[model samples]
Target: MSLLERLNSDMKQAMKNKEKDKLTTIRMVKASLQNEAIKLGTKELSEETELTILSREVKQRKESLHEFDKAGRQDLVDKLRAELAIVELYLPKQLSEEELSEIVKETISEVGAKSKADMGKVMAAIMPKVKGKADGSLVNKFVQQHLS
Candidate 1:
């Protein structure tokens, strides 16, 4: 099933099971999807678009978790962790390091990125292919190391 359909089904299940945390997270996802659809002047969102939104939500939660860790707020950290787990349920599986490395190498070669100066070009070229599958910063770092 499409991500949105799956999400809708999960939302109903959450409601029926009285899973408060899951329900909240699913509601947030539905709202985010609806907002994006409205912004794009569309009645429905594509699976790729929905994945992008879900990835952004997961990324935001990860950043929040990091900040909570930095500030030594265990309670907030724990909450964010739980929310992150819920958010991650909707994201595609992450790429492994070896897979990412292979892509990075191929991207560098394709873009003819000989030095760090070409990092942006290589990244721009590779991002569309890597989007939602790998972490941006990790990809960038790998690209930089290879190019430099």
Candidate 2:
């Protein structure tokens, strides 16, 4: 099924189950997808574009969680955490640390990345491969660790 169809089905299930948090997140996702379609003058977004949107949504939630934590707002932190969980459901299974390390090493080798100056090239080469499957900050750290 297409991402839109899957989201529509999940929206119905969430409504029936009265899962308010999940329902809200799913609705926002639908709205975002529709907005993108309208912006591009297209009827629907591709699966890859949908995945990008989902990844962005999750990243926003993670950043919000961090900010809430820093501000000592436990309530917002918990809320964002719940929302993040809902957003994560659509993502593929995440890579393990060992797997991430291997990918990073491969990317470095592929890009011939040496020293900190080549960070951008390494990142550009790897992000397409990692994207929704791995955390950006973790990947960045690994890149730095390997490069430095």
Candidate 3:
């Protein structure tokens, strides 16, 4: 089933179970997806597009979590943590550091990236391969380590 189908199924379950937080998150995600499809003038989104939107949602929550952590807002931080957890449930399984390292090494060799100067080239080549599976910052860290 597609992401939308999964979300709809889960949404109905959440409503029946009285899971307010989960139901809200599901609705928000569904709305964003529909909005994106409208914005792009499409009837539906491709899996790639869906993954891209989901990744953006995850990234946004992470950024917010970081900010709340620094501000020492425990209440907000806890809420964001919960929301982040729910959002992450839809993302692809994350890549381990070792696995990411291997890909970075392979990509570096393939692109013939000699040093930091080729950071852009390495990132452009690898991001598509990794996409939502790996965090961009983690990928950048690996690329920097391998290149330098």
Candidate 4:
């Protein structure tokens, strides 16, 4: 099923199950997708575009989770953690560190990226290859290690 169909299905299920937290997360994602569609003047978004929007949603929650944790807001931290888990359910399977490291090394070679100075070229060359499949910071760390 397309993401919208899946979301709608899950939304109905959540309602039936009376899963408030899950229902709220699903609604937020649906809203984000709809807003992006409107912003882009498109009736439907491609799979890649949907993934990008979903990734953005996941990133936002993760950032908030970190901030809440640092501030010692246990209540908010737990809530954001739950929300993040619900959101991540829709993301592509994440890459293992070893797999990510291998890809980064290969990309560095492919881009002839030889030093920290070539970080930009390596990242530009690799991000698309791993987009939606790997976390950006992890990818950057691997790239830095390989490049250095």
Candidate 5:
């Protein structure tokens, strides 16, 4: 099934199982997806668009989790961690550092990137290949290390 369909099915299961936290997270994802669709004046969203939205949601949760961790709020951190886990269920399998490094090396060569000056070209070439599979900050780090 498509990601959206799977999400909808899970949402129904959450409701049936009285899983309040899971239900809330799924509803938030659905709302984000619907908002994006409305913004584009379309009822159907492509899988790529859905993945982008899900990644954004996961990023937000991770940021919040970091803040909560710094503040020593274990309760909030735990909740956000659980939410993050739920959001991640829809994302593609994340790339390991070695895998990401390999891709970055290939992209740099493909773009003929030399030195930090060519970071933009290399990044543009790599983003499409890595999107939804790796985090932007992680990719940026790899690009910077390889280019510099």
Candidate 6:
């Protein structure tokens, strides 16, 4: 089934099961997806676009978690962690670090990226291949390490 359908089903299930946290997170995701659709003047988004939106939500949650951790707000951090877990359930299985590293290495060579100056070129070529499978920051770190 499509991501939207799956989300709708899960939302209903969450409501029935009284899973407040999961329900809230799913609602937030649905709202985000709907907003993006409205902004683009479309009724629906493609699977790839949906994945991108989900990834963005996960990234935002992780950043917030980091800030909360730094502030020693355990309650907020725990909440964000739970939300992040729910959001991640919809994402594709993430690539292992070693797998991501290999892909970055291959892309660097494919693009003949030798110096830091070529980071952009290498990233542009590699991101499409990795997309939802790997975090962009992690891929970037690998690229930087390999290039330097």
Q: In order, how many clashes per candidate?
A: 0, 0, 0, 0, 0, 0
lDDT by residue for model 6 over 55-148, one digit each (tens)?
9999999999999999999999999999999999999999999899889889988999899999999999999898788888998899999999
Candidate 1 wrong stretches, greater than 4 Å: none
Q: In candidate 1, which residue pairs get closer than 3 Å at backbone N, Cα or C atoms, i.e. clash?
A: none
lDDT of all predictions, in order shown? Answer: 0.88, 0.91, 0.94, 0.92, 0.94, 0.93
Query: lDDT tens string, model 4, 1-148?
Result: 8998999999999999999999999999999999999999999999999999999999999999899889999999999989989888888899999889889988888888889999999899999999899989989888888877
lDDT of 2 by residue, 5-124 (tens): 888999999999999989998899889889988998999788788888888888888888989999999999998888888888888889999999999999999999889999999999
Give the per-residue lDDT digits (tens) of candidate 5, residues 80-138.
Answer: 99899999988999999999999999999999988999999998999989889999999
lDDT of 3 by residue, 24-93 (tens): 9999899989999999999989999999999999899899999999999999999888888998899899
**Alpha carbon lDDT of residue 125, candidate 1?**
94
The true-versus-predicted C-alpha distance at residue 73 of model 5, in Å, is 1.8
Q: Please report how far candidate 4 places residue 24 from its true position, in Å.
A: 0.3
Q: Please identify model 3 stretches exceeding 4 Å from their true place.
A: none
Instruction: State the lDDT of candidate 1 residue by residue for 33-134, as single tens digits.
Output: 999999999998887898789889988888988998999999999888888888887777889989999999998998888888888899899988888888
- TM-score for each model: 0.94, 0.94, 0.98, 0.98, 0.96, 0.97
